[model samples]
Target: MLLMAITVTGASTLTYFVNDSFISGQLSTASSLDTGTKSVQLLAYDTRDSTTLLQVSNLNNKFGDQKLCGVSCSGGGLTDKIPLNGGTEFIMIKIKNNGINSIFLENIKLNNVVHAWDSQTSGIALNTLQDLSSGGSYPHDGTFSIFSESSIIQSTSNEIPNGNTVNLLIKLGSEDDDILLNKGIKVLLNIGNLNPVEFFIDSGGAQ
Candidate 1:
């Protein structure tokens, strides 16, 4: 039996103001492999374009001047094959918040699974969070079962302050065999806060 792993890295630049803050990040392919005897096919995608690249860079420069924090983000897609029959695979996501303030993650949708995590456990469940062909919310935590060949798992954590991090592990497999697979996975980290800060000028009324 042969196993392969893939890794992807991304970062978010933070901008601060009295109101309405902006957090921008990008996703790109890191590495992959062809585990099969013959070569398998692989594909990757990123939403940023020629113009968006410059825009994001400029935004980073602009935010560098203010009192802001940085986030080191990384994630990726995965797939694997079993020997005789097909087995299971898994992908893990680690989110670390090194900022001075707390951050919230809202509406995080991956492949299509949704859940919530915190700085402590980072949202790990005994049973896998699978999709239902009948259509439903899907289980957030606890034991559950599904009968889908493929699934997209995701979890959201809010108010993560400095020195805090979250970890998410996604597993795919059958009852017989399971492999820890991490490949072509996509990750998006939306870092921002909604709290308002007041500032007073030396010789101004409210400007």
Candidate 2:
């Protein structure tokens, strides 16, 4: 007669705390435009058109859900243009301020063509939310720095102090720039019907 036993386990390295857990796209100001309407309503914790963000927390994406970008994680569906063969990269999002008046953000409209903030190249180019510089030197300076070239995202002081959250940062361009392919980031809110919160960029493809 004989007997034996064995056991093994190892897996615990998932620390994504943007408030200790969040997966709900919330964009408001449409309860019939908040009844009686005085026009001055705009809200978004994760908005990208069609009231996106039913649940998102895997880097950045809630409008259509596509993934593939290696460096930041996920690299395969940014249109699948097949050209960027190198652990690809791209990640930027985390703008908050659930609402209650006190969100005067202004500017941010990338009309696609896949990542194009080439202001002559650098760590982060545009879309403003966050900026890093492992090889360029950027630890914190991404509050939407008024980037232009038709992307129009001015920022003297894009306020957002209700729930608080708006460091703003979006990145991409030159991962072997194979013409990138359909990138997006539009959140031009001045409140109310300031209209402009479109986010539809699915070209994470190739890495």
Candidate 3:
């Protein structure tokens, strides 16, 4: 009976030791990963007129695309009532990333809007507000020296890190065709997978 008891105890010990070794090996080979969310916000919209981003009373409405304010949003559209011309009008869009990840400004596409008759073919440029404040050549004043140094933004390189903001200057014009005239200029600013912030500029006339 003593030998039998000793044999049973030894087997139990051996079983536990093997199980512990297996668990340790399994854990050592295991791998894990984590993920985060990407989000962006259109902080403000600036034009020659007195337009601004305002808060909407109801959160359920989805006709407009404005910056989300917690559970609600502001009405989205050009704040100014009067139409604007592409030549003299420059729309400054302020964008920020308030999410857990960074957002890449992938591209700037124009719908029904053509590039203005300027050296900057894209018609979408980086906002030169800071440069203009210090007498930089942002307005392009039809001078050869000023027109040569246009600050057109390149595609797919602009990065807005978390809590960082960027300003985009948009100036696109309508086609000379009568059908396309006054149809309005639509600017689709793409930032990766997120929905593009849209800007609809009513055409006062061609550039």
Off by over 4 Å in 1: 1-90, 109-157, 170-183, 192-207
Lowest summed lDDT window (length 10), candidate 2: 137-146
RMSD of 2: 20.0
lDDT of each: 0.24, 0.32, 0.38
TM-score ranking from best to worst?
A: 3, 1, 2
User: Which stretch of 10 consecutive residues in model 3 shows the poorest summed lDDT?
Assistant: 141-150
Candidate 1 lDDT over residue span 84-140, tens digit each: 111122223344445444555442323333323322322322222222222212222
Instruction: Predict model 2's lDDT versus the native.
Output: 0.32
Cand. 3 TM to true fold: 0.36
What TM-score against the true fold does each predicted structure earn?
A: 0.26, 0.23, 0.36
- What is the per-residue lDDT of model 3 for residues 81-107, given as tens digits with 9 covering 90 to 100? 112111223344566667666666555
lDDT of 2 at 26: 22
Write down the worst ten-residue block by lDDT for model 1: 198-207
